[model samples]
Target: MAVTRPLLDLVNVTAGYGQTPVLFDVDMSVAEGEIACLLGRNGVGKTTLLRSIIGLNALTSGNIYFNDADITKAPTYKRARKGIAYIPQGREIIPYLTVLDNLKMGFSASGKKAKRIPAEIYDFFPMLKEHLQRQGGLLSGGQQQQLAIARGLMCNPKIILLDEPTEGIQPSIVQEIEDTLRRINIEKGITIIVVEQKIEFARKLAQQFFIMEKGAIVEKGKTDKLADSLLHRYLAV
Candidate 1:
């Protein structure tokens, strides 16, 4: 069954860096517990759309609603507190911080209640529990990616925005990440909006997808309806 209410909604949103526009009147939405993907080629403004939702990229014009409440102008911190989490590209794990401290940083960054790593986090990434004292910089790209995601889960977000979760990741870890994401959505009912360019990856995870072209959503539909022919048409640029 489809969710009766939207967990995240972006209506005709225009946003970008100062004096420069990247996303132009983009319209998108994700239902409660739904897994959606923003699909596009490079420089199509998909990342900008995700950043705009988290308040990292300021909106010049538009209204954003979370749980049906307007929050277009809310600060990033406030948005984080409201159960929205973002794990941008490049992983961005602090090189020197211990794995344990990095996990705590997620809770701290959101101002979420919970000083210690939740037991569920260990369940999500058992390796993190093993390397609690290991420095983040020393872990492999896959392990760091796992840590980055685990950090987001520590915040207990209702929805998570992941930009290219599998980019540069090894195939084995990519599969693990895919299974973990499905588990998160099915087991916890958390909504997931992942920005990805890989067809094989996105097709497996997203129930629906929005295809971006030249800064706008040119096509969208249920994952079952998306075809390789469409990919070659709108997303092959």
Candidate 2:
């Protein structure tokens, strides 16, 4: 049998803001086309982990690898051009920019020439097509989240890092987001690593999971194997 390596790898990654450290010697990997979830209670550094992967937070000590190259010190824009897309916790759409322009921004981040929005973007997010001219801030929270995801896809990334994607959304929209992510993974062959608080959503969306506490991963395994004890210990309020 042929050996397969992870498409994205974090080897002993330790990062933080300024003098205060947050992530401590963290190690993680996501195989090609896999959906992995990072779960934990508040202040466990899940968002910091995602930020580290996207080069937003500088590594204190350790290496990050993507497509077999070390990218620990790469600039944020360089990481984006190298096929890593990050959709942060807040959905961070430009309040005044039209939905079409926000999606174009993602394309521009990849150092690509600005052009017509990709038709496939509409296929993945049909609602965005309807609100192309609408200001992003005027849309509902769920709509904004969808627009954020569609914007990430504009970069044609090999892997996408989503932080708290289902936060502040209604149940119906949550289900839609789940289904669309599955399709994006299966059809587009993009690997995903999501930082999520909702256990049920993580269970349905991810194949592999990691539980973090105090800036380090305490547990990890196949999603189906995640136990109630694990959840109660690390996730319960």
Candidate 3:
């Protein structure tokens, strides 16, 4: 099948922290309303690529485009304002803040005055409703992860970049997260680019898969056609 015009594109991107380059000439795209996964072993530059796309890490070379607009140099706030939400690897919710407050913090970059949580966000993660007043740090790992995602949804983002939503979480919660992601894609039409180390998790959710090795794309194809040998080579257990 022909690939659609990408909602977000990274063309020949090379980025890193300070003097060391981590991502090398990375090129990837997330199509509108599709769940695309970046799969790789640890230290393969998966997080760096996500950071580059979100403007968290400076790119030494190349360009990034979102909704066809060049955002290579856009500040982190600028990217957030432009409907890109990032959920980093650690589910970095503000431990001291209430769950409600954590979600509100995500709207800080919205650049508009808005009151109340978006009903749709709560509809997707209903567990958050009961814990609105609870401290973010007090929630279980699963709950915190849900809050992290709900916080992203509060931004009303066009695309969400998820980094390892299944890591360090219980199997039941992982399934819950997978279901929620599918609903976000099918019902809300949000484009999702997920970076996951777990092959099964990515395989279950992604329409297309890209495997990274030593900071470069080593293989890519529709998820259905992913070769077992390639998985073993790039993501062996």
Candidate 4:
């Protein structure tokens, strides 16, 4: 039998801003086509871990491997071009740009000429098509999150990191986003590493879980028995 390696792996990674270490000796792995969630209380370095994976926060020590290749030192653009996309905590859509233009920006990472918005994008977000001419900032919070996710999809990434995607969004729209993400994962075979505070959202979407505390992962395993007390320590927030 062949031993399959994880698509994304972090070996003893330590990262942070300047000299301050936000992640300490973090070891994590995510196999291809898997949905994994990082759960943690606020200020526990969940976002920092995503930043490290995407090359925004340089690893002070240790290594990062994506698709079994070392990317610890790769620049942010290089990582983006290599099929890693990040939708940050705040849904950083360009406010002044039209929704269409914001989606167009995803093509930049693909190193491909901007063409018509991919049909699949509209399929996943039909509402965006209706509001294509509107400025991104004009959209409500839920709509903007959808736009940001749509933009991430436009990059045609193999792996995407989502930070607190449900934060500040209406439950109805959150459900929509969850359904779309499941479709994307099942249809496109994309891998996701999401940082989420909601247990129901995490349990519904991610098959695996990693719980973080004080800038380090304290527990990790399959989603079975989500009521386990260990999870409460982090989920309590």
Q: What C-alpha lDDT do the candidate models reach, one value each?
A: 0.89, 0.93, 0.90, 0.91
Clashes of 4: 0
TM value for model 3: 0.96
Lowest lDDT sum, 10 consecutive residues, model 1, at 1-10
Query: Quick one: best TM-score, which candidate?
Result: 2
Which ranges of candidate 1 are over 4 A from the true structure? 1-5
- What ranking emerges by TM-score with the best candidate at the front? 2, 4, 3, 1
Q: What would the C-alpha RMSD of candidate 1 be, to one decimal place?
A: 2.4
Q: Write the per-residue lDDT of candidate 2 for residues 63-174, one digit (tens) a residue.
A: 9999888898999999999999999999999989999898899888789899888888899899999999999999999999999999999889999999999999999999
Q: Which candidate, 1 or 2, has the higher TM-score?
A: 2
Task: Compute the lDDT for candidate 2.
Answer: 0.93
Residue 75 shift from truth in candidate 3, angstroms: 0.6
Give lDDT tens digits, candidate 4, residues 1-237.
Answer: 866669999999999888788999999999999999999888999999999999989888999999867999999988888899999999999999999999999999878889989899999999999999999999999999999989998878989999999999999999999999999999999999999988889999999999999988899999875655976566663
How much is 60 displaced in model 2, in angstroms? 0.9
Clash tally, candidates in order: 0, 0, 0, 0
Q: If both were scored by TM-score, which would come out higher, candidate 2 or candidate 3? A: 2
Error in Å for residue 178 of model 3: 0.3
TM-scores of the models, in the given order?
A: 0.95, 0.97, 0.96, 0.97
- Model 2 residue 137 CA deviation (Å) reads 0.4
lDDT of 1 by residue, 1-237 (tens): 754447898999998778888889988889998999989888989888988999998889988999867899999988888999899888898979999988888987678565778788888788899999999999989889999999988878999999999989899999999999999889999999999877888999999999998889999999989988989997773
lDDT of 4: 0.91
Question: Candidate 4: misplaced stretches above 4 Å?
Answer: 1-4
